[model samples]
Target: MTLRGTVRTSYEVLTSRFGPPTFPQVDDGGLPAEDSTLWLIDTPAGRVHVHNWLDVTYFLKRPAAETRWSIQATDDAALPWIYKSVTGSTAAFSAGVHEFSRYSTRVSLARGYVTYLVQRMIALRERGERYDQGSREHRHQIELSRHVGHMALQVQQIVHDVEWAYADDADRRRWTTLPMPQLADEPESQHWHRWTRWTYRPVPTDSRPEGGDPDLVGMLRRRARDQVRFRDRILPANHRGPTREGKVELYDEHIGTLLTLADTALPDTVEQSRS
Candidate 1:
Protein backbone atom coordinates (compact mmCIF):
# COMPACT_ATOMS: atom_id res chain seq x y z
CA MET A 1 0.00 0.00 0.00
CA THR A 2 1.25 3.49 -0.89
CA LEU A 3 1.60 5.97 2.00
CA ARG A 4 -0.95 8.66 1.25
CA GLY A 5 -0.88 10.80 4.39
CA THR A 6 0.10 11.07 8.04
CA VAL A 7 -1.94 12.20 11.05
CA ARG A 8 0.23 13.78 13.78
CA THR A 9 -1.67 12.96 16.93
CA SER A 10 -1.09 11.17 20.24
CA TYR A 11 -1.75 7.49 20.98
CA GLU A 12 -4.54 8.33 23.42
CA VAL A 13 -6.23 10.60 20.87
CA LEU A 14 -6.28 7.80 18.32
CA THR A 15 -7.05 4.87 20.62
CA SER A 16 -9.89 6.68 22.42
CA ARG A 17 -11.81 6.68 19.09
CA PHE A 18 -10.41 3.77 17.05
CA GLY A 19 -9.94 1.47 20.06
CA PRO A 20 -6.54 -0.10 20.91
CA PRO A 21 -4.16 -0.95 18.10
CA THR A 22 -5.08 -4.11 16.24
CA PHE A 23 -1.42 -5.19 16.32
CA PRO A 24 0.44 -3.87 19.35
CA GLN A 25 3.96 -5.15 19.96
CA VAL A 26 4.34 -8.33 22.02
CA ASP A 27 4.17 -7.51 25.74
CA ASP A 28 7.56 -9.02 26.58
CA GLY A 29 9.08 -8.60 23.12
CA GLY A 30 12.65 -7.37 22.81
CA LEU A 31 13.23 -3.64 22.12
CA PRO A 32 13.35 -1.86 18.72
CA ALA A 33 10.10 -3.11 17.21
CA GLU A 34 9.87 -1.53 13.74
CA ASP A 35 6.04 -1.29 13.77
CA SER A 36 5.35 -0.76 17.43
CA THR A 37 1.58 -0.50 17.03
CA LEU A 38 -0.89 -0.65 14.13
CA TRP A 39 -4.52 0.47 13.90
CA LEU A 40 -6.60 -0.71 10.99
CA ILE A 41 -9.26 2.00 10.64
CA ASP A 42 -12.04 1.15 8.22
CA THR A 43 -12.82 4.59 6.80
CA PRO A 44 -15.54 5.23 4.23
CA ALA A 45 -12.85 5.93 1.64
CA GLY A 46 -11.29 2.53 2.37
CA ARG A 47 -9.52 0.61 5.11
CA VAL A 48 -6.41 2.60 6.16
CA HIS A 49 -3.41 1.51 8.23
CA VAL A 50 -2.63 3.96 11.07
CA HIS A 51 0.47 2.81 12.91
CA ASN A 52 3.51 4.02 14.82
CA TRP A 53 6.15 2.87 12.37
CA LEU A 54 9.60 2.66 14.07
CA ASP A 55 8.52 4.80 17.04
CA VAL A 56 9.87 2.40 19.71
CA THR A 57 13.13 4.35 19.80
CA TYR A 58 11.54 7.70 20.69
CA PHE A 59 8.19 6.77 22.25
CA LEU A 60 9.62 6.34 25.74
CA LYS A 61 11.04 9.89 25.82
CA ARG A 62 7.62 11.52 26.24
CA PRO A 63 4.38 10.46 27.87
CA ALA A 64 2.32 8.12 25.66
CA ALA A 65 -0.69 10.47 25.92
CA GLU A 66 1.34 13.44 24.65
CA THR A 67 3.77 11.78 22.25
CA ARG A 68 2.89 12.55 18.61
CA TRP A 69 3.08 9.30 16.64
CA SER A 70 3.23 9.66 12.86
CA ILE A 71 0.16 7.60 12.07
CA GLN A 72 0.26 6.68 8.38
CA ALA A 73 -2.49 5.69 5.99
CA THR A 74 -2.19 4.10 2.53
CA ASP A 75 -5.54 4.77 0.87
CA ASP A 76 -5.39 7.82 -1.43
CA ALA A 77 -8.66 9.24 -0.07
CA ALA A 78 -8.41 7.97 3.48
CA LEU A 79 -7.12 11.14 5.20
CA PRO A 80 -10.35 13.13 4.94
CA TRP A 81 -12.41 10.08 5.80
CA ILE A 82 -10.24 9.42 8.82
CA TYR A 83 -10.62 13.02 10.00
CA LYS A 84 -14.41 12.97 9.48
CA SER A 85 -14.76 9.64 11.23
CA VAL A 86 -12.67 10.73 14.22
CA THR A 87 -14.12 14.24 14.65
CA GLY A 88 -17.66 13.33 13.49
CA SER A 89 -17.68 16.55 11.42
CA THR A 90 -19.59 15.92 8.20
CA ALA A 91 -18.87 19.38 6.78
CA ALA A 92 -16.35 19.90 4.03
CA PHE A 93 -12.82 21.10 4.78
CA SER A 94 -13.79 24.63 3.74
CA ALA A 95 -16.85 24.75 5.95
CA GLY A 96 -17.77 28.16 7.37
CA VAL A 97 -18.85 29.50 10.77
CA HIS A 98 -22.23 27.81 10.69
CA GLU A 99 -20.44 24.62 11.69
CA PHE A 100 -19.15 26.12 14.95
CA SER A 101 -19.49 28.90 17.48
CA ARG A 102 -18.23 32.47 17.03
CA TYR A 103 -14.45 33.09 17.23
CA SER A 104 -14.85 35.23 20.36
CA THR A 105 -16.52 32.36 22.18
CA ARG A 106 -13.63 29.97 21.60
CA VAL A 107 -11.07 32.69 22.29
CA SER A 108 -12.64 33.66 25.63
CA LEU A 109 -12.90 30.01 26.63
CA ALA A 110 -9.31 29.41 25.58
CA ARG A 111 -8.13 32.42 27.57
CA GLY A 112 -9.70 31.09 30.74
CA TYR A 113 -8.42 27.55 30.10
CA VAL A 114 -4.86 28.62 29.30
CA THR A 115 -4.80 30.77 32.42
CA TYR A 116 -5.92 27.82 34.54
CA LEU A 117 -3.39 25.50 32.90
CA VAL A 118 -0.57 27.93 33.62
CA GLN A 119 -1.63 28.16 37.26
CA ARG A 120 -1.75 24.37 37.46
CA MET A 121 1.72 24.04 35.97
CA ILE A 122 3.15 26.55 38.45
CA ALA A 123 1.53 24.81 41.39
CA LEU A 124 2.77 21.43 40.19
CA ARG A 125 6.32 22.72 39.91
CA GLU A 126 6.22 24.17 43.44
CA ARG A 127 4.74 21.03 44.94
CA GLY A 128 7.08 18.76 43.04
CA GLU A 129 10.16 20.55 44.39
CA ARG A 130 9.23 19.68 47.94
CA TYR A 131 9.58 15.92 47.38
CA ASP A 132 12.82 13.93 47.53
CA GLN A 133 14.46 12.80 44.32
CA GLY A 134 13.43 9.41 42.82
CA SER A 135 10.49 9.22 45.24
CA ARG A 136 7.00 8.21 44.04
CA GLU A 137 5.53 11.58 45.04
CA HIS A 138 8.06 13.45 42.87
CA ARG A 139 7.47 11.07 39.96
CA HIS A 140 3.74 11.58 40.24
CA GLN A 141 4.24 15.36 40.14
CA ILE A 142 6.44 14.99 37.10
CA GLU A 143 3.71 13.01 35.36
CA LEU A 144 1.08 15.58 36.31
CA SER A 145 3.27 18.42 35.01
CA ARG A 146 3.68 16.69 31.66
CA HIS A 147 -0.06 16.12 31.36
CA VAL A 148 -0.75 19.76 32.19
CA GLY A 149 1.65 20.84 29.43
CA HIS A 150 -0.02 18.43 27.01
CA MET A 151 -3.41 19.90 27.91
CA ALA A 152 -2.09 23.41 27.15
CA LEU A 153 -1.00 22.28 23.67
CA GLN A 154 -4.39 20.63 23.10
CA VAL A 155 -6.17 23.89 23.97
CA GLN A 156 -3.85 25.74 21.57
CA GLN A 157 -4.73 23.37 18.75
CA ILE A 158 -8.50 23.81 19.28
CA VAL A 159 -8.43 27.62 19.58
CA HIS A 160 -6.10 28.12 16.60
CA ASP A 161 -8.88 26.97 14.25
CA VAL A 162 -10.25 30.49 13.74
CA GLU A 163 -11.60 30.36 10.18
CA TRP A 164 -14.37 27.82 10.84
CA ALA A 165 -15.14 29.41 14.21
CA TYR A 166 -15.70 33.08 13.34
CA ALA A 167 -19.13 34.19 12.07
CA ASP A 168 -18.48 37.24 9.81
CA ASP A 169 -16.87 40.64 9.80
CA ALA A 170 -19.55 42.06 12.11
CA ASP A 171 -19.28 39.11 14.48
CA ARG A 172 -15.47 39.18 14.29
CA ARG A 173 -15.21 42.82 15.35
CA ARG A 174 -15.68 42.68 19.13
CA TRP A 175 -14.43 43.86 22.50
CA THR A 176 -13.52 41.81 25.62
CA THR A 177 -17.25 41.41 26.43
CA LEU A 178 -17.05 44.38 28.79
CA PRO A 179 -16.89 48.09 27.96
CA MET A 180 -15.40 49.03 31.31
CA PRO A 181 -12.01 47.32 31.30
CA GLN A 182 -10.31 46.29 34.52
CA LEU A 183 -7.63 48.76 35.62
CA ALA A 184 -4.21 48.22 37.20
CA ASP A 185 -5.52 48.93 40.70
CA GLU A 186 -3.16 51.89 41.09
CA PRO A 187 -3.93 55.37 39.75
CA GLU A 188 -2.94 55.87 36.09
CA SER A 189 -1.08 59.10 37.05
CA GLN A 190 1.85 56.96 38.23
CA HIS A 191 2.46 55.40 34.78
CA TRP A 192 1.03 57.90 32.25
CA HIS A 193 1.91 61.48 31.44
CA ARG A 194 -0.60 64.33 32.02
CA TRP A 195 -1.90 63.96 28.44
CA THR A 196 -2.89 60.26 28.50
CA ARG A 197 -3.92 60.35 32.17
CA TRP A 198 -7.18 62.19 31.49
CA THR A 199 -8.23 59.59 28.89
CA TYR A 200 -8.17 56.87 31.56
CA ARG A 201 -11.62 57.48 32.99
CA PRO A 202 -13.42 55.13 35.40
CA VAL A 203 -16.59 54.19 33.53
CA PRO A 204 -19.63 52.53 35.13
CA THR A 205 -19.75 48.78 34.50
CA ASP A 206 -23.57 48.62 34.81
CA SER A 207 -23.87 49.23 31.07
CA ARG A 208 -21.15 46.75 30.18
CA PRO A 209 -21.96 43.43 28.56
CA GLU A 210 -22.50 40.46 30.86
CA GLY A 211 -21.23 37.64 28.62
CA GLY A 212 -22.72 37.61 25.16
CA ASP A 213 -22.69 40.03 22.20
CA PRO A 214 -22.00 43.58 23.33
CA ASP A 215 -23.42 46.83 21.94
CA LEU A 216 -20.27 47.63 19.97
CA VAL A 217 -21.70 50.77 18.37
CA GLY A 218 -22.48 52.25 21.77
CA MET A 219 -19.15 51.09 23.12
CA LEU A 220 -17.26 52.79 20.32
CA ARG A 221 -19.18 56.03 20.83
CA ARG A 222 -18.47 56.03 24.56
CA ARG A 223 -14.84 55.04 23.99
CA ALA A 224 -14.22 57.87 21.53
CA ARG A 225 -15.97 60.43 23.72
CA ASP A 226 -14.10 59.40 26.82
CA GLN A 227 -10.64 58.83 25.31
CA VAL A 228 -10.41 61.47 22.54
CA ARG A 229 -10.41 64.47 24.88
CA PHE A 230 -7.15 65.79 23.38
CA ARG A 231 -8.73 66.24 19.89
CA ASP A 232 -11.64 68.30 21.24
CA ARG A 233 -10.79 70.43 24.29
CA ILE A 234 -7.11 69.94 25.20
CA LEU A 235 -4.45 71.72 23.16
CA PRO A 236 -2.13 68.94 21.94
CA ALA A 237 1.48 69.61 21.07
CA ASN A 238 3.55 67.93 18.33
CA HIS A 239 7.30 67.91 18.90
CA ARG A 240 9.72 66.39 16.38
CA GLY A 241 13.21 65.26 17.25
CA PRO A 242 16.12 67.30 15.93
CA THR A 243 17.36 64.65 13.51
CA ARG A 244 15.98 61.50 11.87
CA GLU A 245 18.99 59.56 13.20
CA GLY A 246 18.05 60.48 16.80
CA LYS A 247 14.43 59.31 16.41
CA VAL A 248 15.55 56.13 14.66
CA GLU A 249 18.11 55.47 17.42
CA LEU A 250 15.46 55.88 20.14
CA TYR A 251 13.09 53.59 18.28
CA ASP A 252 15.84 51.00 17.77
CA GLU A 253 16.59 51.06 21.48
CA HIS A 254 12.94 50.41 22.37
CA ILE A 255 11.96 48.22 19.42
CA GLY A 256 10.96 45.31 21.66
CA THR A 257 8.50 47.44 23.64
CA LEU A 258 7.14 48.97 20.41
CA LEU A 259 6.60 45.55 18.87
CA THR A 260 4.83 44.28 22.02
CA LEU A 261 2.56 47.35 22.03
CA ALA A 262 1.78 46.85 18.35
CA ASP A 263 0.99 43.17 18.94
CA THR A 264 -1.43 44.03 21.77
CA ALA A 265 -2.97 47.01 19.92
CA LEU A 266 -3.60 45.39 16.50
CA PRO A 267 -4.80 41.81 16.61
CA ASP A 268 -5.22 39.92 13.34
CA THR A 269 -8.67 38.93 12.12
CA VAL A 270 -9.53 35.39 11.04
CA GLU A 271 -9.87 36.49 7.40
CA GLN A 272 -6.58 38.37 7.43
CA SER A 273 -4.59 35.46 8.89
CA ARG A 274 -6.18 32.16 7.90
CA SER A 275 -3.48 29.65 7.07
Candidate 2:
Protein backbone atom coordinates (compact mmCIF):
# COMPACT_ATOMS: atom_id res chain seq x y z
CA MET A 1 0.00 0.00 0.00
CA THR A 2 2.77 2.47 0.89
CA LEU A 3 5.21 1.98 -1.95
CA ARG A 4 7.98 4.44 -2.70
CA GLY A 5 10.84 4.35 -5.20
CA THR A 6 12.33 6.45 -8.00
CA VAL A 7 10.54 7.78 -11.11
CA ARG A 8 9.32 4.25 -11.75
CA THR A 9 7.13 4.43 -8.63
CA SER A 10 4.57 6.75 -10.26
CA TYR A 11 4.76 4.83 -13.52
CA GLU A 12 3.78 1.65 -11.72
CA VAL A 13 0.82 3.35 -10.07
CA LEU A 14 -0.63 4.65 -13.36
CA THR A 15 0.00 1.37 -15.12
CA SER A 16 -1.83 -0.60 -12.44
CA ARG A 17 -5.16 1.01 -13.30
CA PHE A 18 -4.90 2.51 -16.78
CA GLY A 19 -2.52 -0.14 -18.13
CA PRO A 20 0.30 2.20 -18.99
CA PRO A 21 -0.62 5.78 -19.66
CA THR A 22 1.15 6.69 -22.87
CA PHE A 23 3.30 9.81 -22.58
CA PRO A 24 3.89 11.80 -25.70
CA GLN A 25 7.51 12.88 -25.96
CA VAL A 26 7.53 16.14 -24.01
CA ASP A 27 10.09 18.96 -24.12
CA ASP A 28 9.43 22.07 -22.08
CA GLY A 29 12.82 22.91 -20.51
CA GLY A 30 14.92 20.45 -18.38
CA LEU A 31 15.39 16.87 -17.31
CA PRO A 32 13.84 16.21 -13.91
CA ALA A 33 16.27 16.47 -10.99
CA GLU A 34 15.62 13.17 -9.20
CA ASP A 35 13.12 14.80 -6.81
CA SER A 36 10.05 14.78 -9.05
CA THR A 37 6.96 12.77 -8.00
CA LEU A 38 4.40 10.25 -9.13
CA TRP A 39 1.34 9.91 -6.93
CA LEU A 40 -1.66 7.60 -6.48
CA ILE A 41 -3.86 9.84 -4.43
CA ASP A 42 -6.81 8.75 -2.32
CA THR A 43 -8.94 11.48 -0.83
CA PRO A 44 -11.19 10.96 2.19
CA ALA A 45 -14.86 10.31 1.53
CA GLY A 46 -16.80 13.55 0.99
CA ARG A 47 -13.64 15.64 1.24
CA VAL A 48 -11.45 16.86 -1.59
CA HIS A 49 -7.70 17.04 -1.28
CA VAL A 50 -4.99 18.40 -3.54
CA HIS A 51 -1.29 17.57 -3.42
CA ASN A 52 1.12 20.45 -3.80
CA TRP A 53 4.05 22.00 -1.87
CA LEU A 54 2.03 24.56 0.02
CA ASP A 55 1.78 24.71 3.82
CA VAL A 56 -1.92 25.15 4.45
CA THR A 57 -3.23 22.98 7.28
CA TYR A 58 -6.64 21.34 7.23
CA PHE A 59 -8.18 19.34 10.09
CA LEU A 60 -8.05 15.53 10.03
CA LYS A 61 -5.57 15.18 7.16
CA ARG A 62 -4.37 11.60 6.58
CA PRO A 63 -1.54 10.22 4.52
CA ALA A 64 -2.81 8.43 1.46
CA ALA A 65 -2.23 4.66 1.37
CA GLU A 66 -0.04 4.78 -1.65
CA THR A 67 -0.68 1.97 -4.12
CA ARG A 68 1.96 3.32 -6.50
CA TRP A 69 3.86 6.58 -6.59
CA SER A 70 6.48 8.39 -8.68
CA ILE A 71 8.41 11.56 -7.89
CA GLN A 72 8.63 14.45 -10.34
CA ALA A 73 9.83 18.05 -10.14
CA THR A 74 7.61 20.60 -8.42
CA ASP A 75 10.10 23.39 -7.73
CA ASP A 76 9.57 24.93 -11.12
CA ALA A 77 6.92 27.65 -11.12
CA ALA A 78 3.80 27.75 -13.28
CA LEU A 79 2.58 30.72 -15.28
CA PRO A 80 0.72 33.16 -13.04
CA TRP A 81 -2.48 32.74 -15.01
CA ILE A 82 -2.56 29.02 -14.31
CA TYR A 83 -2.44 29.61 -10.58
CA LYS A 84 -5.09 32.32 -10.82
CA SER A 85 -7.57 30.19 -12.75
CA VAL A 86 -6.97 27.09 -10.67
CA THR A 87 -7.54 29.02 -7.46
CA GLY A 88 -10.72 30.46 -8.90
CA SER A 89 -11.89 26.96 -9.74
CA THR A 90 -11.27 25.46 -6.30
CA ALA A 91 -12.83 28.47 -4.61
CA ALA A 92 -15.86 28.21 -6.83
CA PHE A 93 -16.08 24.51 -6.15
CA SER A 94 -15.77 24.85 -2.39
CA ALA A 95 -18.31 27.65 -2.17
CA GLY A 96 -21.45 26.22 -3.75
CA VAL A 97 -19.66 22.96 -4.42
CA HIS A 98 -21.16 20.06 -6.24
CA GLU A 99 -19.27 16.80 -6.57
CA PHE A 100 -18.74 16.49 -10.27
CA SER A 101 -15.35 15.35 -9.10
CA ARG A 102 -14.08 13.23 -11.97
CA TYR A 103 -14.00 15.82 -14.76
CA SER A 104 -13.00 18.60 -12.41
CA THR A 105 -10.07 16.59 -11.10
CA ARG A 106 -8.99 15.62 -14.61
CA VAL A 107 -8.87 19.22 -15.77
CA SER A 108 -6.81 20.25 -12.74
CA LEU A 109 -4.37 17.36 -13.20
CA ALA A 110 -3.98 18.08 -16.90
CA ARG A 111 -3.19 21.73 -16.21
CA GLY A 112 -0.62 20.83 -13.56
CA TYR A 113 1.03 18.32 -15.87
CA VAL A 114 1.27 20.81 -18.70
CA THR A 115 2.75 23.49 -16.43
CA TYR A 116 5.36 21.07 -15.06
CA LEU A 117 6.36 19.86 -18.51
CA VAL A 118 6.79 23.36 -19.83
CA GLN A 119 9.08 24.21 -16.94
CA ARG A 120 11.14 21.07 -17.57
CA MET A 121 11.51 21.83 -21.28
CA ILE A 122 12.78 25.33 -20.53
CA ALA A 123 15.38 23.89 -18.19
CA LEU A 124 16.52 21.38 -20.79
CA ARG A 125 16.80 24.07 -23.44
CA GLU A 126 19.08 26.03 -21.12
CA ARG A 127 21.33 23.02 -20.48
CA GLY A 128 21.57 22.08 -24.14
CA GLU A 129 23.41 25.26 -25.06
CA ARG A 130 26.67 24.05 -23.40
CA TYR A 131 26.74 20.60 -25.01
CA ASP A 132 29.76 19.12 -26.84
CA GLN A 133 29.03 17.18 -30.03
CA GLY A 134 28.71 13.39 -29.67
CA SER A 135 28.58 13.67 -25.90
CA ARG A 136 25.94 11.77 -23.88
CA GLU A 137 24.69 15.02 -22.38
CA HIS A 138 24.29 16.44 -25.86
CA ARG A 139 22.24 13.45 -26.94
CA HIS A 140 20.05 13.76 -23.86
CA GLN A 141 19.48 17.39 -24.70
CA ILE A 142 18.09 16.45 -28.10
CA GLU A 143 15.77 13.88 -26.56
CA LEU A 144 14.46 16.33 -23.96
CA SER A 145 13.63 18.86 -26.61
CA ARG A 146 11.66 16.23 -28.48
CA HIS A 147 9.62 15.51 -25.37
CA VAL A 148 9.04 19.19 -24.76
CA GLY A 149 7.62 19.63 -28.23
CA HIS A 150 5.21 16.76 -27.69
CA MET A 151 4.10 18.05 -24.30
CA ALA A 152 3.55 21.51 -25.70
CA LEU A 153 1.28 20.05 -28.33
CA GLN A 154 -0.63 18.12 -25.73
CA VAL A 155 -1.11 21.21 -23.54
CA GLN A 156 -2.46 23.13 -26.50
CA GLN A 157 -5.12 20.54 -27.19
CA ILE A 158 -6.49 20.56 -23.66
CA VAL A 159 -6.93 24.32 -23.85
CA HIS A 160 -8.70 24.13 -27.18
CA ASP A 161 -11.28 21.62 -26.03
CA VAL A 162 -12.18 23.47 -22.83
CA GLU A 163 -12.41 26.81 -24.57
CA TRP A 164 -14.51 25.27 -27.27
CA ALA A 165 -16.84 23.90 -24.63
CA TYR A 166 -17.13 27.16 -22.71
CA ALA A 167 -17.42 29.46 -25.71
CA ASP A 168 -20.19 27.48 -27.30
CA ASP A 169 -23.45 29.32 -27.95
CA ALA A 170 -25.47 27.13 -25.63
CA ASP A 171 -22.96 27.45 -22.80
CA ARG A 172 -22.80 31.21 -23.35
CA ARG A 173 -26.53 31.67 -22.97
CA ARG A 174 -26.53 29.59 -19.84
CA TRP A 175 -23.71 31.42 -17.97
CA THR A 176 -25.05 34.89 -18.64
CA THR A 177 -22.63 37.44 -20.02
CA LEU A 178 -20.83 40.12 -17.98
CA PRO A 179 -19.72 42.89 -20.29
CA MET A 180 -18.07 45.05 -17.61
CA PRO A 181 -16.84 44.87 -14.05
CA GLN A 182 -15.73 47.46 -11.50
CA LEU A 183 -12.07 48.46 -11.21
CA ALA A 184 -10.33 48.48 -7.81
CA ASP A 185 -8.25 51.49 -8.85
CA GLU A 186 -11.35 53.60 -9.39
CA PRO A 187 -12.07 55.86 -6.48
CA GLU A 188 -15.22 54.95 -4.58
CA SER A 189 -16.76 58.29 -5.48
CA GLN A 190 -15.69 58.00 -9.17
CA HIS A 191 -16.43 54.26 -9.48
CA TRP A 192 -19.78 54.73 -11.08
CA HIS A 193 -18.28 56.78 -13.93
CA ARG A 194 -15.19 54.61 -14.56
CA TRP A 195 -16.83 51.52 -16.01
CA THR A 196 -15.10 50.04 -19.06
CA ARG A 197 -16.36 46.86 -20.69
CA TRP A 198 -14.48 43.62 -21.20
CA THR A 199 -15.19 41.74 -24.38
CA TYR A 200 -14.58 38.52 -22.43
CA ARG A 201 -17.84 37.02 -21.14
CA PRO A 202 -19.43 33.86 -19.77
CA VAL A 203 -22.84 32.37 -20.54
CA PRO A 204 -25.77 31.03 -18.42
CA THR A 205 -26.47 34.22 -16.39
CA ASP A 206 -24.98 37.61 -15.65
CA SER A 207 -25.39 37.54 -11.88
CA ARG A 208 -21.75 38.20 -10.98
CA PRO A 209 -21.29 41.78 -12.13
CA GLU A 210 -22.86 44.84 -10.52
CA GLY A 211 -23.58 46.16 -14.01
CA GLY A 212 -22.20 45.94 -17.55
CA ASP A 213 -22.35 47.89 -20.77
CA PRO A 214 -25.53 47.01 -22.66
CA ASP A 215 -23.83 46.90 -26.06
CA LEU A 216 -20.91 44.71 -24.92
CA VAL A 217 -23.28 42.28 -23.18
CA GLY A 218 -25.22 41.62 -26.36
CA MET A 219 -22.08 41.19 -28.46
CA LEU A 220 -20.47 38.78 -25.99
CA ARG A 221 -23.63 36.68 -25.73
CA ARG A 222 -23.87 36.30 -29.51
CA ARG A 223 -20.22 35.31 -29.78
CA ALA A 224 -20.57 32.83 -26.94
CA ARG A 225 -23.57 31.29 -28.70
CA ASP A 226 -21.74 30.89 -31.99
CA GLN A 227 -18.72 29.19 -30.39
CA VAL A 228 -20.83 26.76 -28.34
CA ARG A 229 -22.56 25.54 -31.47
CA PHE A 230 -19.23 25.08 -33.20
CA ARG A 231 -17.72 23.08 -30.33
CA ASP A 232 -20.75 20.87 -29.53
CA ARG A 233 -20.18 19.09 -32.82
CA ILE A 234 -16.69 18.09 -31.73
CA LEU A 235 -17.10 16.86 -28.10
CA PRO A 236 -17.33 13.08 -27.88
CA ALA A 237 -19.88 11.55 -25.48
CA ASN A 238 -16.99 10.16 -23.48
CA HIS A 239 -14.68 13.11 -22.92
CA ARG A 240 -11.83 10.66 -22.48
CA GLY A 241 -12.60 9.01 -25.80
CA PRO A 242 -9.82 6.97 -27.44
CA THR A 243 -8.64 9.92 -29.50
CA ARG A 244 -9.27 12.61 -26.87
CA GLU A 245 -5.63 13.34 -26.15
CA GLY A 246 -4.71 12.98 -29.79
CA LYS A 247 -7.43 15.39 -30.90
CA VAL A 248 -6.18 17.90 -28.30
CA GLU A 249 -2.63 17.56 -29.62
CA LEU A 250 -3.81 18.32 -33.16
CA TYR A 251 -5.56 21.47 -31.99
CA ASP A 252 -2.51 22.60 -29.99
CA GLU A 253 -0.22 22.29 -33.01
CA HIS A 254 -2.40 24.24 -35.44
CA ILE A 255 -4.34 26.69 -33.31
CA GLY A 256 -2.96 29.37 -31.02
CA THR A 257 -4.52 30.81 -27.79
CA LEU A 258 -4.79 27.27 -26.46
CA LEU A 259 -3.46 28.38 -23.08
CA THR A 260 -5.88 31.24 -22.60
CA LEU A 261 -9.07 29.20 -22.69
CA ALA A 262 -7.93 25.90 -21.14
CA ASP A 263 -8.15 27.37 -17.65
CA THR A 264 -11.43 29.25 -17.94
CA ALA A 265 -14.11 26.73 -18.93
CA LEU A 266 -16.78 25.24 -16.67
CA PRO A 267 -15.90 23.58 -13.41
CA ASP A 268 -16.97 19.92 -13.26
CA THR A 269 -20.42 20.72 -11.88
CA VAL A 270 -21.69 23.02 -14.62
CA GLU A 271 -23.22 20.40 -16.87
CA GLN A 272 -24.98 18.42 -14.13
CA SER A 273 -25.89 21.54 -12.17
CA ARG A 274 -27.49 23.04 -15.26
CA SER A 275 -29.62 19.96 -15.83
In angstroms, give how far residue 243 of model 2 lies from its true place. 27
lDDT tens digits, residues 111-155, model 1? Answer: 333334444455675677799977767766765665555444433
Who wins the lDDT comparison? 1
Q: Give the TM-score of candidate 1.
A: 0.28
TM-score of predicted model 2?
A: 0.29
Would you give me the overall lDDT of model 1?
0.41
Under the 3 Å rule for N, CA and C atoms, how many clashes does model 2 have? 41
- Tell me each candidate's TM-score: 0.28, 0.29
